[model samples]
Target: MSQISEEEKQYVVFRLGSEVFGIDINKVKEIIVYQEPTHMPGSSEFIEGIINLRGHVIPIFSLRKKFNFPEAGDMGKTRIIVVEAGNSTVGIVVDGVSEVVMISGSVIEKPSSLLTSTVDENYITGVAKMESGLVIILDLEKVIGRDMAEAI
Candidate 1:
């Protein structure tokens, strides 16, 4: 069984278009300013492009696109969240990162079958109830899925 201890799990919250969401801080490698990524032909639609991250050619993918949201240009504090999923590291673009929050295992609740929250349940492991509301905890594996090619 996958053991989920009471250890505090940090999460970074951000907005995807309009909805607010979050991912485990452990998955977020680093936060970087928005940069024009170099295009790589024959890649998936969600794969925005790649960039040379201090000698490491990191491919940046749009999380919005992956969730079927309309594309938006870098206007505000758009950033690339370096993440490791399925043993592969990749960059996920977000509107802006709010703050790193700590959530214990006991506080994490199973996803409610709320019709409004039906977008990507599989990519979500649980929901963290917060004073603001509830922050969706994403599943790292499902977010990256099979994007090993671009990640490598």
Candidate 2:
């Protein structure tokens, strides 16, 4: 059987366009300034390409494209949030990364089924209610998908 903990969870918040989203802090490796990735032929459209981070070649994907957000204008605010999912590490491009915040798990509510029509509900673990606004918590595994994660 599985158990649920009431412990507070930390998340790294980021902006895609006008919307703000959050990812589990444990999955995040690091956040770096945006850099143009080398284009790879015949790869997925969302896959911006790859970059050599330190010594490792990491594939970078556009979270805006994946989420159907408009292309970013200012590169200055852009950032690449490198995250470790499963056995591979991938970088996700975001408009900007805000401060990390801790919130009790009890404050997270399961996403409504209606959201499935606009977004793949599987990608969203839950919705966190914050004083500022609602923060959509992303399930990195589901957001990247098993096939893509394996390919990375």
Candidate 3:
């Protein structure tokens, strides 16, 4: 089997409140325009509900609520990023997608212990230092949680 090169990694950068965050590009299936989700009874607060994508029912999650960020105001730039986590295809809502960046593995550092207070450290894989700014790399598996993924 061919191995993935560690020399560089591509990430899909997005905004959450004032901070920037990224996810592995390979995990992202597509980015779609924001649409109101149909609320599901007895779902978690972070779970914005589900959307019918083509013939598939995809669960939508609000990253702002998941990260404890204040509710967003304008919806103009909002987007739903469809990602594959485990066996589930989930859509994560973000303020907006910035750009796709390819950064060398050297610039990525382990998450600092201090960040645990602001956000769950388990959800963060690393912090990437880029020319634009720091991007908090998220562990999609942890963010999507095994149980939640299975349920969806």
Q: List clash counts for every candidate, in order.
A: 0, 0, 0
- Badly placed stretches (over 4 Å) of model 2 are 1-5, 115-117, 147-151
* RMSD, every candidate, angstroms: 3.1, 2.9, 4.0
* lDDT (0 to 1) per candidate: 0.77, 0.84, 0.86
Task: Judge candidate 2 at residue 140 and give its lDDT.
Answer: 93
The candidate that achieves the highest lDDT relative to the unseen native structure: 3
Error of 1 at 19 (Å): 1.7
| Rank order (by TM-score, best first) | 3, 2, 1
lDDT of model number 3: 0.86
Q: C-alpha displacement of 97 in model 2, angstroms?
A: 0.5
Candidate 3 weakest ten by summed lDDT: 1-10
lDDT of 2 by residue, 39-109 (tens): 98878888899999999998998777787777888889999999987778999999899889997777777
lDDT of 1: 0.77
Off by over 4 Å in 3: 1-6
Task: Enumerate residue pairs that collide in model 1.
Answer: none
Model 2 scores a C-alpha lDDT of 0.84
